[model samples]
Target: MSAASPLRVVCLVPSWTETLIEAGVNVVGRTRYCVHPADRVSTIPVVGGTKDVNWEKVAAQTPDMVVFDQEENTQAMADSCPYPWVATNVTSVQAMPAALEQLAKALNCDALLHMAERYRAALAAPVSRSGRQLPLLSDKHNSSLSVLNDDRPLLYLIWRKPYMTVGTDTFIHSLFTHLGLPLITPGERYPEVDENWLVQHKPVLLCASEPYPFAGKLNAVKDELQLDALLIDGEPLCWYGIRSLRFLESLQSS
Candidate 1:
């Protein structure tokens, strides 16, 4: 595939869909669930969602390629489609830019190089910051920072019921570790836990991300969670895009 080719790509993952737009790809169809920057996606073609998709409509469109995130979307949707497709699953912040580069190449959009490079730089810019040390937790468990019990512990709850925490071996943990922070949260991804554990650990900060918007109710949710911590935008730790540099820039002032 060459960058000059005018390819029609379908994005089934909400976040990756957003990434493709940021990378300047021609997205012909998107799952109804992939919403971000409302203005851009509002009027776009509405395909099916992660678990379900309008295969007939997708096939009828004759997309040159289909992009899938195994975590947010499934391969079954692309199977038997009229054109070729690719699927990816990115688990951490560092892998995000590389994955975006791969996606751009797959889409044959060399013009996307600038955007991909920016995100890649954002992923690496934290190395120079002068900090006392920051506390970290991830969607994984048994981390290298686990040995530093003195650091504050953060819990990334992907689900409410059974209340989960980030474990070791996750990308969120990897990013925090680079900043000289300790990741004490247990389990890979979100896992069930208790308020007692939260009260005991009491992280200095909590990050609320999309898939569930926590921006409006930060204080209320903080109180309800029984943790004395400030809730910050989860995108700085999660979302990968040109805006990520803005997040990194703000880190010094923060």
Candidate 2:
């Protein structure tokens, strides 16, 4: 539907929720985790979360269409949706612009179409490294660890307590690949690792700041693992859609 005839949508993907709202789509419902554009999304009704959607609450919204992501919402949720639904599967940096274009076509939002074009242009621009290095340790830690410069293999951590990391197939891994960082993990989707695994692999560690609040426990994690670990922003690394465009732009300047 065009902006003149906007479709009432229930968006479950957090990143897409932000994109659709910014694109001026009529978002009637959203999951609890869709917390972007805080001023705008606060007014929308909640339909549970990415995995545990409240179908009844979603039905209450009486939305014209429901949005899902292949990596965020479950297949059963989409299959069980009583109303019309659409799902976007974006698994890499190269796939994001096309996904935005497809969504723009589906929603008939010119803003989204423009955003897709911007993403395309940003992706086409050459990335400038400028020799910027990410700090690997906090000031409190007395370690010889410094910022990363070389092409050493890195293992990015998303969760702890039986730590979890993304595989080569995930969107996060694709972003890492875009940054020219070599990943040491296997090809499987989110793989769980233990202290033993970390010791055996001995890859540089990067703890993401979301899905587990890794930033708060960075020191503890470093102490426990006895490995050089850095806290990273999870949003730019993992969140796709419009955020991906901004991320690409940032890389172009870097």
Candidate 3:
């Protein structure tokens, strides 16, 4: 008796693309937005973007599995998958491990679990410290978690030009909630807020590097809001996968 070989896959989610590549799986196609592992991603065939997936191109690849992020890919695309497909819904920082685990099991890949373990270990240690002390967000310490010790109110922005911000429904919101930070939103997803609003609330503002470039243009915010503004990498705050592990590692040194 012979077992079937591993399935060829197509990943519509950027995070899933990295995770599958890290697990040493054969990912035959990816959406245009799957740009992580920048050097290698370009060589892979592009099916389409998440919002406008090319089902015909994906079908031509004959991939055994098509992985899409629930939030990134439209439901219409998921319905069009002729082959076996999996939808990843890693919407919160806390759901990453479970999400990876499920995807691994779905594909019968043990390497994916190993990658998840690496992520868990990476987050559980301070890269410079004894490699045991967990930082702001840790699943290890439950009862006496230190994330709640700080009440530093902060607002994270994801977009500009009308000024959309982090809301309770987003992974970024969960990240701050785990860190016990006071997060304020305009009571709606992607609600518009201005500098005057920042002046009134007076919280540290973090400008993300994607969706809209916020650097150099925020000098006025620094002066007008009278607050500390940091332009940060948006991937860790948004994507919940291998890049996130790397992000946590960087935070250790920063």
TM-score top scorer: 2
Per-residue alpha-carbon lDDT of candidate 3 for residues 32-146, written as tens digits (9 for 90 to 100): 8888888888889999998888878887888998888788889998887788888978667777778878888777788878767876765566444221222222222122322
Against the reference, the lDDT scores of all candidates come to 0.61, 0.79, 0.70
Mind giving the per-residue lDDT tens digits that candidate 1 earns over 43-64?
Answer: 6787798878887878766788
Better of 2 and 3 by TM-score: 2
For candidate 3, the 10 contiguous residues with the lowest summed lDDT are 130-139
lDDT (C-alpha) at residue 38 in model 1: 70
Q: Looking at model 2, which ten-residue stretch has the lowest summed lDDT?
A: 130-139
Better of 1 and 3 by TM-score: 3
Q: Assess every candidate by TM-score.
A: 0.75, 0.90, 0.80
State the displacement of the C-alpha of residue 218, model 2, in Å, after optimal TM-score superposition. Answer: 0.8
Number of the predicted model whose lDDT against the real structure is largest: 2
Ranking of all predicted structures according to lDDT, beginning with the best and ending with the worst: 2, 3, 1
Q: 1 or 2: which has the higher lDDT?
A: 2
